[model samples]
Every structure is written in C-alpha cells, then in structure tokens.
Target: MNTQIKGRTISLRLVRKEDAKFIYSLRNNKEYNQHLSQASGTVKDQELWINEYKNRENKGAEYYFIIERLDNEKRIGTLRLYDFIGNKESFCWGSWILNQDKTRSSAIESAMLVYEFAFKELHFASCHFDVRKKNINVIKFHKKFGAEITNETNLDLFFQLTKTSYGDFFTRNNKFIEN
Candidate 1:
C-alpha cells in the first residue's frame, strides 16, 4: 500500500505516534464525534492504540492516515480504510474527521484521495461505510459520490460504492482532483 497519497489540495500519509494528540482531539470533539461512537481514552492510551494499530496497518488489515493541507501543510484530518470483507476486494471506510475550518472544500479532496487510493491504487472493487442515520449532512455527502444506501440498522445506514460508480461521479460532476 502506498504510504502517501496526494490530491490537488490535500495529502494523506500514514499516521504516526505524534498524531495521538490530534486523533484524541478529533475523536473527542463533539462536532466531529457526536454522530459516531465515543472514544474514551487518554493521550497515553491513544499512543498505545496507535502502536497496536501500526502492526495491523502494516499487515494491510487497515490503513490509517493523517490528512494535511497541501498548500499550508497543516494537519487537518484523519482517515482509514479497514474491515476487509469477503474476497478482501472490498473494505469499510471510516475514521473521517476534519477540522471545521478546513471543511469547506478540502473535505471533498480528502475523500477523493482515499477513493483514488482504494479503487485505483489498491485495485479494490468497492468500498462500504456506515453513517449514523441522524448525520444527514454526511449521508448527503456520500450520496454525492454515487454511494447507494444498501442496508440499514436501527441506528446507522450503510452505503456502498463500486469503483465504476466512483469514477463516473467525478467524470459527470467535473470535480476530479489532480492526482
């Protein structure tokens, strides 16, 4: 797996120990975490979580990344590709969090980077992720990517997207970010 993925306005690189603080902050920030499961851990606990995840990440069971602004080089978000499924050709995507100040357009570019990395770089056939039913904004955002709601649980809705759909989304919308 590639360690770094660059888009027109953002970059995604492997998460490091130093990111524990940022991860802790993002995971605990109400604006970003309220719709998701709460992360209950101290910074030391977060560091250990990073170490444990490092091994799993290296084995390709998961990919964790820190998102940074390309122009100013400011770290603004986090992302992950995990939960490898049947045939291992599809995976769940989550851990998407960005600082509020940078969400205007960088959010789109950041997600595009992950999609490009998964469908193009890793040759993954599709990707799936769950969003809380109440997170309407994010649900709408996923729909913009041609993701279809494939399932629903009491508290969450699952969206799935094939590589072809992702490709066509950008092609039709004319929003393809430079690789």
Candidate 2:
C-alpha cells in the first residue's frame, strides 16, 4: 500500500515519530479539540505513542496520517484509519483535526483522500465512523458526502458510507479529487 496519498492540492503521509510535536499541538488546540477525545501528556509521550503505533502500522492493523500542503509541504492536519471490522469489509476512521487558519479546502480534500485510500488502496467496502453529537458542521459534512446515519447515542452519531455511496459522491465532487 502507498505510504503517501496525494490529492489536487494536499497529500497525506504516514505519521512518523518526528511529527510528535505537531500532533501534540493540534490535539491540544482549543479550536479543534472540542469534538475530539482529550489528549494529554508531553511531546515525549506522543513520540512514545507513535513508536508503538508504528508497530501496528507495520502489521497492517492501523494507519495515522499527517496532512500537508503539496505546494509548501507544510503539515496542516492529522487523521487516522483504524478499527477494521467485518474482515476488512469496513473500517473506522477518526482523529480528524485540521488547522483553522488554513484554507477550508483542506477539510474536503483530506476526507476525499481518506476515502480514496480506504476504498481504492485498502479495498474496504465501506467506511464507518462516529461524530460527536455537538459537532454539527461535521455531521453536515458527512451527510453531504452521502453517509447515512445508522445509529445515535447520547454522545455520538454513527454513520456509514458504502463504496457505492462514495462513488456517487465522487461523481458530484470530482473537482476536488480530479486532476
């Protein structure tokens, strides 16, 4: 599988131990951390965590990505793909956090890239994830991408997007992913 997935304006590369500082900053950024699980500890802790994560990555159990702008090659965001289910028929992805100061396109492009990697590269039939109930904007974003809400709880809403649904979304949003 490819280590880096490039899009029209941005690319996603596997997270390395060296990215601990950046990841730590993003995890603690008030603007982006509201909807995410609380992250604590120093950059050293993050580095240690990444060291362990690398082993899972090697075993094909999970993937964490650092999103960067292709023009300047600056790291701008982070996302992860994990929680494989149904014998590779579906996968769960979360930990999506992006810099607020950057262009909004980063959000769209990063998501497009994730779906591309999951479906095209990993051959997963569908993507399933949960969004915090209070994260309305993200809920809308997934709905617009044709993800169906399958369940909801006190804290989160679960959604699913099949490959067919993504194919349809791709047809409509081709500009974001096309050359």
Query: Each candidate: what lDDT?
Result: 0.86, 0.91
Candidate 1 lDDT by residue in tens digits, 50-82: 999999987878899999887887899998889
lDDT of 1: 0.86
Runs of candidate 1 exceeding 4 Å displacement: 173-176
What TM-scores do the predictions have? Answer: 0.94, 0.97
- Local error of candidate 1 at 82, Å? 0.3
| Model 1 worst lDDT window (10 residues) | 170-179
Error of 1 at 47 (Å): 0.5
Candidate 2, position 159, lDDT: 99
* Residue range 36-136, candidate 2, lDDT tens digits: 99998999999999999999999999999999988888899999999998867999999998885455688888999999889988899999999999999
Q: Could you tell me how far off, in angstroms, the CA of residue 96 lies in candidate 2 after the best superposition?
A: 0.3
